[model samples]
Target: MAIDILSHRDPKVATDILKIQQESYAVEAELINFSDIPPFRDSVQSIVENDETFIGYMIEEKIVGVLAYKEEQEEIDIYRMMVDPAYFRRGIGESLLKHLFATMPNKPVVVQTGKGNEPAVNLYLKYGFEPVDEVEVEPDVWIVMMKKAQ
Candidate 1:
């Protein structure tokens, strides 16, 4: 499996990305009003046209994962990231993270995850991301913010 990170907005890779989304976030994805669990969106033309802020991981020419971030003057704020379940536990997430650490300047990288999602929190911690704050989004849904830096 080859790893290729590309602009999150790449059009050629949307379909595969969409498939991964549909399979990964089914119900939780719908809570966000999404018909599917896309890291971003399939028709968000920006996913392919916007290059100022977005990144994705490709395998054998297909986009099996994605990482979207906003580059700020101080740190990179991650918007979303998801790996096709079939590709989980394979270090692809870590690779994308490593890529961010390698390319980000000097500010901490920020990310958010479902409050109860231990796996995500663990992944962040494994990469040195620590909890910074927590906020309630819905009456029952809380989000934990984590940050990491070089």
Candidate 2:
């Protein structure tokens, strides 16, 4: 298993990232009972044009997980955390989060996930992220925003 930076400019890389993203977000959509999560609408072209930095977790050269984030002067905003369902329960997401914390230390970290997604919320809470807000995005759907202080 290896984790490395992924260039969105590479078509093949962008395609792989998009595939993992769709598959992963599909699970989140089901958990939240909402299918309109923004990542589902992404294409390879859109991923290639995105401004976030992507890091991929690989096994034998195949990307099995991806984490995308943007670093700013005050904080690091985590945009996406995806692990292929076929590769779930293997610590891929935790590994990617650890990599981010290691590489971008001393910055507040922020992320949002489905309010009903227990696994994701637990993971963030386990790592010291506290729930800061909960926004209802749809009639019955909500998103929870979490933050970890610097």
Q: By lDDT, who's the top model here?
A: 2
lDDT of 1 at 135: 88
Inter-residue clash pairs, candidate 2 = none
Candidate 2 lDDT over 19-84, as tens digits, reads 999999999999999999999989999999999999999999999999999998889999999999
Candidate-wise lDDT, in order: 0.69, 0.94
Looking at model 1, the pairs that clash are: 8-54, 9-47, 9-48
What is the Cα-based TM-score of model 2?
A: 0.98
Where model 1 places Cα greater than 4 Å from the true spot, the runs are 7-10, 27-42, 49-52
**Which window of ten consecutive residues has the lowest lDDT sum in model 2?**
98-107
Clashes of each: 3, 0
Give the per-residue lDDT of model 1 (tens digit) for 22-133.
5655533444433322344555464556544545677667776677688888878987777888878888778888887877787888999876666677899998998989
